[model samples]
Target: THSGTSLGGGDDLGAYFGLGTATGVDRLEVRWPSGLVQVLEAVAVDQRLTVVESGLLAELRPLTWPIEIGSAGGSFAYRLGVTNLTEASVEVDVWLHIEGPKGVSITRGPIRRQLGAGSSLGLTGSQNVPGGAPSGAYTMTLKVGTFPIAEQTASFSFSKRRGTGRAEGGGCRPGLGRKL
Candidate 1:
């Protein structure tokens, strides 16, 4: 049986089975949403185990390391690879999360795509840094399906840029701002 929740409510995302005094499961079968069926033998009982979809791979590749952010803010780009190694085509949903300093977080789409059998798809995109984001370390997490497949961390630092200053009064005067 599957779990369901009402609107504005939450529920546990786990499946429970009553073994009825059975010692362990001899076989376990899972039918995934992608039309892929997986079978496990000799499964243990009374323990939590993560089941990752077979023949699907997700990878995160950052174009730059230790991203630098200026006072005016900046943007970072990355490449994501999703491969289907099975004999049949499957549909996948990709999600991204970037967690920054001071509990700042950014979430990106469940970008849905269909991949042919034994083929790979590349997704490239950039994310803008909020102007008020603090300079510190950040982590980007990639999730394929319900599993987090990859994670990468980078540092963000503020760089000083020159700006023109205005005169105290309305007079025509030009001055340079303070250098960092």
Candidate 2:
């Protein structure tokens, strides 16, 4: 069948297998030059299959984000959790964007840390509100790896000094609305 019309097994042309019928190839058999016989079942026609000796692949996944917000003394505190899903360890950077009254915005630093695969890291931080600060609502955005994961808004106002306690009239108190 090598009358120059053969489809394969020639010099630098590689080996090729052809199915003559239109009923779709149900099975394929391969006999390697190393005297190893392999059979594949339920294979369709005109489809390609890659055979690898040692199976190895690369996997990429996004990190998981969970956040919690609460009051820490005179400051607003928050706990952020980051879960890594990659095969290798990854370094994560955390950023905070705070939007307050009168179009005030505060951008926090790029807190960098290493996170192992399938492990989670918890970070606790507080945003201090200075004494006699304005009474208004604030929005805190948590950004992980250049993406906004979660946002929390809380209102603050100055309460009247009722008793001789740490929470004086000068300190800011949590207002009525708080959304997690």
Over the full model, what C-alpha lDDT does candidate 2 score relative to the true structure?
Answer: 0.44
lDDT of 2 by residue, 69-94 (tens): 22222444445555554567766665
Clashing pairs in 2: none
The residue-by-residue lDDT of candidate 1 on 1-180, one tens digit each, is 245643334464466677888889976777777765555546788887677667776666656665555545566666676677789988776676666667877666656668899999776666565445665666665556532432111223322222332211122111111110
TM-score of 2: 0.40
Q: Which pairs of residues collide in candidate 1?
A: none
Count backbone overlaps in model 2. Answer: 0
- For each candidate in the order shown, give its overall lDDT on alpha carbons: 0.57, 0.44
